[model samples]
Target: MDTIPAILRAAAERYGDQPAYVEGARAVSFAELHDQVRELARRYVGHGLAAGEPVVVWGPNSIEWVIAALATTYAGGTLVPANSRYTGHEVADLVDRTGATVVMVADGFLGRSQVQELRAASDLPSVRAMGELSRLSLDHRGEERHVREVTIDEVEARADAVSPDDVADILFTSGTTGRPKGAMSAHRQSIGVARAWAELGGVSADDRYLVVNPFFHSFGYKIGILVGLLTGATLYPVATFDVDQTMQLIESERITLLPGAPTIYQSLLTAPGRAERDLSSLRLAVTGAAVVPVVLIERMRDELAIDHVVTAFGMTEAVVVTMCRDGDSAETVATTCGRAIPGMETRIDAPAGEAGELLVRGDYVMLGYLDDPAATAEAIDADGWLHTGDVGVLDDEGNLRITDRLKDMYISGGFNVYPAEVEQALMRMDGIQDVAVVGVPDERMGEVGKAYVVGTASADEVIAFARQRLANFKVPRLVETVEALPRNLSGKVLKNELRK
Candidate 1:
């Protein structure tokens, strides 16, 4: 499909009554999903969302989130998804950066009224409309004002106006600069990457896909949601990954396709009473976002009885870059993120068999970072190569093994945590003279943050202070008081020493 709206229309015609999305007690057929998206798009148009404008969707995974995200694109508006784990300050910064006109949040989710928090964080003068995602309808009065009902014809007109080159979503990813950058992807690129992933995984209409990744992430939104849309796979979105709840869903829903970080499969393998859960319906398991052990890959196939188990490597800039193919050996799947997919090219700056910065150029690469030309130029060179900021080695067979990162970022529970951002937040606290953060290996999480401080505050006090400011995954799990951090002659803190 050329665009997301086009995919929605085609899915309705192709899949007809086949189930598209199933959440708890509710399910929507492909046809029904198309109708719902159109209805919601009409409401968005009635609410004064203009073409090319950005709408921020900040919430957990649910059928409502699906509809709202799809409706935002269907209404000719760019989708800007915010991390649900973000505090009001984080969300406000994103909203301000995007100049979002409509901000839809999942109120009362996890016992917090997100809209109120966002309002309390900022005056939000640019936000002309705000509402709870669950209560988004033409007749429902939003926090700011009521929506003006518009006809389906108007919605169709807007959808027809959308081009493949139009920016579909602007996903924010933090950098070493301690600031988040919005990566803009066109409708074609989003659908293109999803289609590529779906083809590689052999996703089909009969497959029941269980999505455990957060919808705000590229893993969930692009590979999970869009892949399902392209392949007609019925999606089962899990708002949170509880072992018992996921196992119950797998048994009840007869889930066939499951993709998540390595930790998810590890949990399922070790959860109490896993054998009794009737997990025979699981056919495919795709995992990444953290190191995947060869033993874990074998266990997922042998213990869980999943027929197809694979691994991939991707980022927010380019959703699915390299992925292990079917029938790949366990070692290959575990140690390497297979060769580049179709429409993409991969190369290392170093000689063959040596590890260097990985570079990629592809049609599915993001358009650019939103409103940041200098940063965009630095990332994607004039030759169209996007410097991935990752150190990797390519073997004779062209398989890529990631070794290290040029950026001081780590993955905690599959979430990208930038140490610079954590250090920036901690420096704001009183009596904190200086700080340095690094990722330490963990048994449960792939990596957790550790902070080395040069200040008078106790470890517990610093941890408590961080809890109120940073997201849970970004918070340092361990703290150490040091007289000073080792620095280079150039006055730069040597992060390698801290990592050691």
Candidate 2:
């Protein structure tokens, strides 16, 4: 079961009649999912997609997106999930870079015709556009006798042909630092991470996972879909994170597992009608992608009634390398991300207790950025460590606490300011709900810190409060209140956007 098709076949047999995926009122059983994947595999093969070829599944979170991704593997093709928020130009560029032979996109998502928009923006060069399969009812009459009939055995046999070294996916990096590069990973790598994620999250067959994170992001796709497939859990796909609907789903659907960014939990805890809902069903929570406050974790456990609130640190290139364990202290879960998972090794470049770049090495790391040899060489050094540009520290107990991105560290006067440290300090202050700090140009001192507070605190008051807690040089020179900070689909603060 190192390959996706192998995993799919095992799940179908093991889970049988159990529901594997649920989208609103509709549910797809394991047996049905396997049948549909095989049927679609036939369709894909009929259209000439083969092993090692790329097929871009571009759409939001839905059952169709899931099938499209898995079916590509069943057809022995590589999956390239496009970010739903990508503009036409971005999508076209990605398609071109991947040399994708087929493009399966949602006909309409969130009320917009994405396929039409793509056609309008680019000619799409030489790719086949398959309209949304969200509601596709395949009534294949086996009319094409030339195309071989696909069965579970045949699918498994074909999956066997796809070697562990064959590229399973080419997930593109977030490109916050530079241009987005496709990070290629093999079947073994993908399968390894899937198992590790399930084990770390304590995912079980009886658990019902509410996936508020989009399918395009690694956390949602790897942990959300792959983990469910591996563990035989039921997956509830949530297209967007609406606090009211999510609260209702947790109550009515009896969702036990929910994983997303800190902002999602923050929204749920502070949501208008949250206290009135019966949220006692939530048991496990995983959050990352920003500075997580101790109070947030405490509220998620105490108020929301979630039992295990774990924090993890990962990126697309290297999936869940580190995660807080079940027996970790609340302070450990709150302050640090976690130690490295079983198969991987994590090291920081700086001295112990000092922040430096975090490096990871193991089966979890990607082969390299696709087609960008120089960049790939630079990322994964000769020593076999992937130089994660993220900055963090390894405490005495080996817990990893992320402080800032190497690119995000800014110099102020003669000192360096990690925005995450500044934000964490501001989060502890009263009347501040959320905060993001960025270095702004200051004639007096090369670059000074500017804080964006999402609360009722005034600019002058916040600056004064920070002055008392922080060193004179580290305190923010300016503070501004905003309705909300601009964030990417993954809920990471777009400090680059804030700078503009």
Candidate 3:
């Protein structure tokens, strides 16, 4: 099987001068990108990073980010991207789990530096700063090896030695059971995701890709970086998701593809000069992490003039189970998250209703969560059916519809209440823009619902509005109105933070 770097070699041979990645004022051609990966991989090998070992890639999206990722694959090392938002302790835990011998990071991001904080991890392999990495040379292998450069032959020959089943990345995902688990993705399967995305979307070398999702995320790291590489599509890296900045870049660059969450889109819509901006170059858009309401789809198609909107579903495991297929009706694209991708088995279990734990069985499933065998056993069964803790169902045509998340369900006065239901109910109310419902501890009922709302309505007004429709028990006892609720990089509600 062709390794990840081999895809670049193909692009280099076929479309050498074609621009492969673009960031700010720079654009890297396919041939140039490949050479950079080759040199960087050689540098990695020269530094003594072996095939069986791993390297921690921590930083936001940038041209260097993709270079480091591909370089790791070429050098035959597992790529473990530490969460950019991770605390020093959290990063330390990931480093320990991956057993990375080298950590590659970008320069001072957001003025709050990381190189120093990450170096403090006693368990760290070696800290390699971005500023130092730019100066990496392979000639001297051992002259202060915390971050040295290695050669093309050394990396490519090892790349030739690497196989499909080799662990490519250890992506840590927050599990429903409290602690996070590291999901191992293999080389071939990583390519499978890339291939599935390209085939589904018909992405080609002509496309200019804008990656707004965090580089650490599987959706962005694997599908965006790896898949974009496979297709020879030029990558436009966004370090942050500022609305005005994103809009300006889109209009200026004419970015052909955008892979981001709904919140990012929402933010961009609200940006000043947004309606006047010329975004005709954006041919395709992909959004996930949360359900995309029909209204959002209408807005994108009507307002943004995007031709196709792909709603994808999957975590680190299962790669991506289902997506709204090309030419699907707007309703399906907006509501149902389409059928299973090739080589993946998606089922609704006993009865396909409005909601259930979405079950999947596939080779793409993670080898197991890093050092969490008990949790691994609970998530992925012996027969290899990954029991996704998310609550969803298969619609009439078998399209997967995610209504609520299993763990996010709260018990209110002995009645189990899924927050999505309450949130959906709240979303229907006039002047109620966004809603996040979480269970607050209550002595009498064990737990009562509390809503953290964003937008116009005040606490009393929103509660009174809810009381008109919902039963007394279902109404939120304590409504805390806020400008915005905390969310993960993927735009997933940080329920844990709300609980805290």
Q: Of the candidates shown, which would achieve the greatest TM-score relative to the real structure? A: 1
For candidate 1, what is the TM-score?
0.97
In terms of lDDT, which candidate is stronger, 2 or 3? Answer: 2
Q: What TM-score would each prediction reach against the true structure?
A: 0.97, 0.80, 0.79
Model 3: per-residue lDDT, tens digit, 115-230? 66655655364433232333333323234645444455566789888888888888876544434578887888888877987889889988888888778888788778887768
**lDDT of each model, Cα atoms only?**
0.91, 0.80, 0.75
What residue runs in model 1 are displaced by over 4 Å at the alpha carbon? Answer: 137-147
Those runs of model 2 whose alpha carbons end farther than 4 Å from true positions after fitting are 137-157, 409-500
Q: Residue-wise lDDT of candidate 2 within 135-253, one digit each (tens)?
A: 64232222343434445566556666887788989987634343568999898888889899888778899999999887877778888888888999999998766889999998999
Question: In candidate 3, which residue ranges exceed 4 Å CA deviation?
Answer: 121-151, 352-354, 409-500
- Residue range with the least summed lDDT across 10 consecutive positions in model 3: 129-138
lDDT of 1 by residue, 1-500 (tens): 58899999999999999999999898899999999899888878887889999989999999889999999999999999999888888999999989988888998888887877887888877776776788764333347666677999989989999999999999999999999999999999999999999998899999999989999999899988898889999999888889999999999989999899898998999999997889999999988888788999999989999999988888999998999999999999999999899999899999877899999999988999999999999999999999999999998888989999999899999899999999999999997899999999999999999999999999998999898778789999999999999999998899899988
Give, for candidate 1, the lowest lDDT window spanning 10 residues.
137-146
Q: lDDT of model 1 at residue 158?
A: 92
